[model samples]
Target: MKKIHLVWSFFCVMYVSLAIAAHAEEKIIQGKEEIEKSICELNIKGQIEKEFHLYVTDGYQEMADGEMIYFWGFTHAKDFADVEEIKTKAERNAKLLPLKVPGDEIRLTSGRNYVVVLHNAGWYETEEHSGINHVAHTIHFHGLDLIPALDGVPNLPYPSVFPGEIYRYLLTIPEDIEGTYMGHCHVDSTNHIMSGMYFPIIIEKKPNEIYGYTFDREYTLFMSELDSEYMETLREVGDIRRGLDWNSNYFMLNGRIFMDNLTHPLSTINDPKTRIVAYDGETVLVRLLALGYEHIFAWHPHGFHGLVIGTDGRKFPFAYEKDTLLIGSGERYDILYKIPDFSSKRKCLSCNYGPGISIAHDHNMKGMVSGGIYPHGPMTIFDIRPKKMTP
Candidate 1:
């Protein structure tokens, strides 16, 4: 049919001229503190001037206040903006995750007032286009005191730019020992993380022989996704609004989302809604956070086999066996499983053995689904108790 409509009209005008040449004329750089260390950069120059294709955002099932809230982020601009054909790649790159959100939300407080005038840090008297090898800092952040009006908004900082764009910084890995580290934004001049920036960096591991063991009760979390139309077009041009634009599709752990299972009704131990069971070694300590893309948050302690001491946040020199544990994306692991006992007719301490299996997913395979929406996305679960059991 006329050569398939002339090759689909020359592939939709070479895909809108390579999505306007990978977001035309782009240049970014956030902060790179140095009095002891700090870094975040983005300088994608731009020049696809022809072809593109990028997609990867699969998360979202919102409700906001009426509850039911599940979100995720990162689409790297839909993986690159649907490339059809045109040719030309002088440059087109990406790097993100420099987070510092907490201005009492109003969509990240008008995207941090357009990010303090598109990022403006201090101490740059001028090094002639201060272009590479470093030079730009202006960090702050003081939220999270149980969120009382973001309690004295000051400590949260990272607005140090110079032809910069694409950031999210908050680093402090003073060699917390234990290996595996990654903090993006070295910029190449295009596709700046599909234009939502980026995030994922964690450090917490130090103290001999792999990660000795010591715990009482722990829980750490991190998983991402967002593509609400490219984070609402970068919060409307870098104003940076955030309520939900996730694109992680499946980056899971800790109850991944809405329901992997949560149903324990039918009480009878005096019926107050029972739930508490776990005996036969009884030792619990789990901490696994895998922020920003890249998967592998697997930990299935069905009958028990977990002992891994640490991974991304360091700690592991004497406690390794695995029933399956492989976390990534700014990693962090500190498992120590030992809770599997039921027999005596699945032992129901009066009626407290409804749900207690142990499973934490995200074995990659396209995460779990959100943009594909099957039971939300991600994954999570953990419930085992036996202090002599009561109710």
Candidate 2:
């Protein structure tokens, strides 16, 4: 009886030791998975830390009609090796350095944190708007459910970012909300938004998690209009409220007229870049957004139709194919464009041949013109090239 008791005690102790060791191993594996997931969430270059400094300044953009339009815009604050380098560079070309094109697009992944440092660089006078200079600006992210303090609304949540003042915005892209959203200035929206303080915000889902579909390439189109009259009125009156009667003279795709859209590469011309390049037999995803306050754009692709898979960041129950889509103001559409084989002899609805450059333009003929110039507004090309061989 004494021998049996000794063996039972020894077996019980060994079982408890083994159980504790297994639990510890499980915890270590869990910790490793958590670390790997965090690394995977980093930016494309694997840099875990990223910061974007957006400097708001006033400038001029030459329109396709040879008219220089006065504009209030944002430029990325270029990084310098040190403070002395920045000061030295500023002294030489202070005028030319801040006067860049539209702001860069803010790309985020779901379940990640981002810090957007907004700096209101001092105002500048333009020849077109000689009397008026740029003023306080705020970033209002459309369709984001943010706290009131970070909403970027003047007088309601937080005051406008004053000139020479810096404001840091802490934002988290929620896992549930993933898609294309718009960001613009909420201060005097009518004037500021039309003045080009806007860009697209794309929140992507997890790597293995598919959102109803998949694609090989992605492109974004921010359909907007330029109300030159309204801008001029604001310049003269210094109040956006007084410029209520608005008339848009220039239609744009990603802040460029039709000609720039055809010439410039993807993401080089403007914020919410518009150009698209894909290989034959590849699936391309197009994120379409209309920023106009009143205009509804009828988006049409010439060569092939697109499969309408999602709208306003939500997947559709049934996907439908259409050649033209009527997108209303503040609306978003996710279109999947599947390229056919290059050798296939497919004919488009308008009797165009396939596997070539397709003219994607607004079906609203009026939106295809810039100051009465036909075929010179909001048109871009979808170039489908033959697949290249791997080295």
Candidate 3:
């Protein structure tokens, strides 16, 4: 394992300063529209095309232990014509959404042209020798078949998208392609994606419909693993090569570790967009996407089994039922969970224990802990609250 001291040494001082500075930061978690605006990176969606303005910037996520793990991610660019104007917590919080590790959710429709504009705004942390200041980034649409021109492999065309510049991608997704997919940085992908440059992408057959099934609502769980020391090395010297010392010690679902998920403002359970909430007799669609250096996540829901509907943006001809779903690096699964009518004891067999609170955790033994601490890795919930209750 990477020396723990090096990790915290970089974080300890930053946390003290960033924590105080972020106190007055503006948070967009109030109104419904504002919340959606914060979580979704898609800027515009037309009938024939969807447009996105993604800003490549550096940010930090405070781990369960209060250590801020430095990462590079994609956030929404409020203005299509701006670059690297903000650096402080207050400035970033006011002007841009703090970058999430798995970036942001982008919903797509089958057979539509997608226009993605990526602006390399720049990094925030000014650690000398981090090599972050001179780096170029690109977004490779994973699990999607696109031409070499539209595909985002670096140097395939030229020097790549550097800071203060923007790259435009005109994507055409086939009509029959609709399922769970992802977009991530391809240049030094091992370092960038592990440092938090990926995001969830869902291509639907149509709105709220997939593979001839409809659901009341949907949630996405972006699973990832991070080694604070590994990130420290990246931010210290921008090492793109994989090292034998690499040890991913923090496992996450939607950016935050477990236990923290129960309370963190940006966690899976607290984030209304990601928390699996459903009324009785309704179907809930869950898009599970994962990435890690060497981790396999066995997703285990406590009470009910989910119907495995799709994978890697392809619909399954025959759906299967699985309670503990296994996910590997770069894999995406679309699962449909039909919440039975819990008002009646005989409504559906095996759902007798649901409708209140059900814990969904990573059964991959190692994923249950962060930095070797038990019960602190990826864990979330499926809640069916009182119909009138509000967050």
Q: Give the TM-score of candidate 2.
A: 0.75
Per-residue alpha-carbon lDDT of candidate 3 for residues 1-391, written as tens digits (9 for 90 to 100) = 3678878977988997788655423221123234244334443444336568888888777765577888888898554334444455466667777776778778788777767877777776747766677788998899988766557887554236887777667666788888888999898777778888898888877888988889878888888898888887777786667555679989998887765435666455676655677766778899998999999999988767999998887778999999999999999999998877662232223324343777788999899888778778788777765544533
Clashing pairs in 2: none
Better of 2 and 3 by lDDT: 3
Better of 1 and 3 by TM-score: 3
Write one digit per residue (lDDT tens) for candidate 1, span 259-303. Answer: 423442211111111111334445555554454433445544344
Q: Go through the candidates in order and give each one's C-alpha lDDT.
A: 0.35, 0.69, 0.76
- Arrange candidates, best lDDT first: 3, 2, 1
Top of the candidates by TM-score: 3
- TM-score of model number 1: 0.30
Superposition error at 131 for model 1 (Å): 23
User: Any runs in candidate 3 off by more than 4 Å, and if so which?
Assistant: 1-48, 78-94, 260-267, 343-355, 386-391
Each candidate's TM vs. the true structure?
A: 0.30, 0.75, 0.79
Q: Model 3: which residue pairs collide?
A: none
| Model 2 alpha-carbon miss at residue 303, Å | 1.6
